[model samples]
Target: MAVTCDLSAERFVDRWSDYVGAPPLTCGIVDVGERTRPTVSGVDPDRVRTVSDPGNLQHLHDAVETHLSELPDADRTVVYLDTVNALLDHVPIPSVTGFLDRLTSSLSALGAVSCASFETGERGERTIRPVTETFGTVFELGRLGRSLEPTDDQLSSDDVFEVLSSRSQRLVLRSLLRAEGTLHVRELAQRIAAAQTTEQPDIEQIVTRLHHIDLPKLRETGLVAVEDRVVSATEVVTEVEPYLALAHPDERN
Candidate 1:
């Protein structure tokens, strides 16, 4: 089952279409937010439910209870909950923590794994300490390695796909991956524009876009680092390298 907190089902599918398309999910999707019904059209889930009042924890509990009661016996199931941090918007930190405790416990009893995400700065370090301690595992994003090579701490397929969603970001990543070391922002911009097949690549426009959009995104995803006037790829680029190849099977890596 997919439990969307602040995220919509359409956005989720956009990021995980590769997994959702294959092995077609004969599953359920729960939309929990302002919208009382499914926000994305053309996706009629077999068993779907929605909890519109995000501020009402009781409403959320009731929705999950209905879902749990309807689910058939299975050895394994997974619950994906995006925007765990968004709960903080409606409830107190202690309340949200308690809610997660009960939810995770319920999933565990059902033999289902709970995969949740939390945005940084939604809660302070002190507030987050107990919350992080509750989870079995936690992943701290944005720490980059020296080289753009695969590592034990590789990103998940979901993370990789999310990063690849933006074409401009992908262009920046590929440029960084090919470079031996740091590349000046201007040099990187020229290459990206050149790849667009423009006879006169606009260096100024490309620089502006990278500075305002692409570079910030790459940094947020930990795919690349921007320092001074230069950029460099990180270990994440290597993890995504395979997917890029699959995306363009005709081209050699």
Candidate 2:
């Protein structure tokens, strides 16, 4: 006899939601591409203690150490490290292996599952080695740019600003946007540090400035809804698509 199970995405989300609410712990996100946006929706906004750019393994390691304090003693924490299109340039085998070893040691100490997803390509082969050696589950997310889909989950304040504002602000916004919703100033700072790349400017001061000034400007414009450290995007796609088109006309197909 065959058996049926409710394993649809909605059912998975519902079950995951219940788990998040009952026992809280720190969950880490090592987002390496624009794909950072979707992983943000996987956990409760309140429970996400650390979100870092996996591009910098050292920073990723440090963030995990700091946030491990927030997890429950017995409840297992999980780390979702995503390195899709982000590591296509030079392959660093030693650094990658070292980071994975450290990450494995940390997660094992806490009794957590360290899940890593890599996009399939020559790069994926280079990237997945460390993750597969350390973590139990590894998923291949096909080629980059071909299957990029943003979740219908409400846009975070950071994502809205990214799609609407200038480049510098957009960088700052992407990290914050990926958080379940709003985030504390310190949390945003850590994320900015982790997500920093050569092309992006230093965001420490800008993050501070947002609390005092720019956030209000965005709120006044109805682009963002701010209540303390929490920020939500109020503007829908229709309002932002034109701006996006102006900024990135090449994205038009």
List lDDT for all candidates, in order: 0.71, 0.49
Task: List runs of model 1 lying over 4 Å from the truth.
Answer: 18-24, 39-46, 143-253
**In model 2, which residue pairs have backbone atoms overlapping below 3 Å?**
none
Which residue pairs collide in model 1, if any?
Answer: none
How do the residues 194-221 of candidate 2 rate in per-residue lDDT, one tens digit apiece? 6455566466675777777656665655
Per-residue error (Å), model 2, residue 230: 64
